[model samples]
Target: MSRIGKQPVALPDGVTASVSGQTIEVKGPKATKSFTATDDVTLEVQDGVVVVTPRGKSKRARQQWGMTRTIVANLVHGAKDVFKKELEIRGVGYRAQMQGNTLKLNLGYSHDVDFDVPEGVTVTAPKPTELVVEGTDKQLVGQVAANIRDWRRPEPYKGKGIRYKGEYIFQKEGKKK
Candidate 1:
């Protein structure tokens, strides 16, 4: 049995969930999100809660049980509130600023990197070195932050580059005799 699947996801006040076949849709004040579970798992909304159960005793079914439950929980949470990811830019002259819907990054490159902000997600630069990504969809918010960080991943030698807030980059010794 899956411990996580055993626990139903509660629907908070102002949040509602509905199930149709294998798909579950959650609606809240912030947003409405829907997810379709695989055939190995079943989705149901009952008594102000969402429940997920496996259709069979197979290993795949067992695996999908927990995964499906978590997905449903994420949908509910995302519908009710926004998800956020923060990034930090380290190194001299490296900075970021928002230009309309685009994020302009200066990561020590000869030319500035222009990142087009996709719909449904908002990228804000509170400071030159700080960036905050927010969206109703958790995956999209995290992916946008990762893409921004990929332009200048921290190097072990100088530990200078774009990185997630609180992320530690393991440093290596410099050239020695």
Candidate 2:
């Protein structure tokens, strides 16, 4: 038996989980997430807890069972608690602002970069340099944040660019005169 797969996932208050065929749906107060299990994996809900089991005894089945369970658990947690990513714009003139559903970034470039925020995600700028990304889906939120940060990634020379809050960029010493 797989260790992670054998463990039961406890459903939090105000969260609901349902299994139908190969699909699992998790509904929470904030949002809902759905996942489809592999052919060799089976999901069961017992006494408000979710259990994942493999259909047959095989190495591949064993490997997939635990992975599927963890993915489902993440989906449940994400729907309830959500996920967030914070970014900081460095440099003198670099800044970010929210214009309707789009994020406008001024990263010392002649033209401002505009990014359209996808559905199911929210972006907020508490400060001109600070950006907060929130969404129920962890993968989507992270990808969006990475895309934004890629516009002007922090450099090792001067470290003037966009980066995650609290992230450090190592500075290199200049050549001796």
Give the best candidate by lDDT.
Answer: 1
Candidate 2 clashes between residue pairs 3 or more apart in a chain or in different chains: none
Could you tell me every candidate's TM-score relative to the true structure? 0.97, 0.91
TM-score for candidate 2:
0.91
Those runs of model 1 whose alpha carbons end farther than 4 Å from true positions after fitting are none
Candidate 2 Cα lDDT to native: 0.92
What does the lDDT read for residue 78 in candidate 2?
90
Count: clashes, candidate 2: 0
- The residue pairs found clashing in candidate 1 are none
Residues 33-118 of candidate 2 have per-residue lDDT tens digits of 89998899899999989999998999889999999988888888896898899999989999999999999999988999999999
Angstrom error of the Cα, residue 19, model 1: value is 0.5
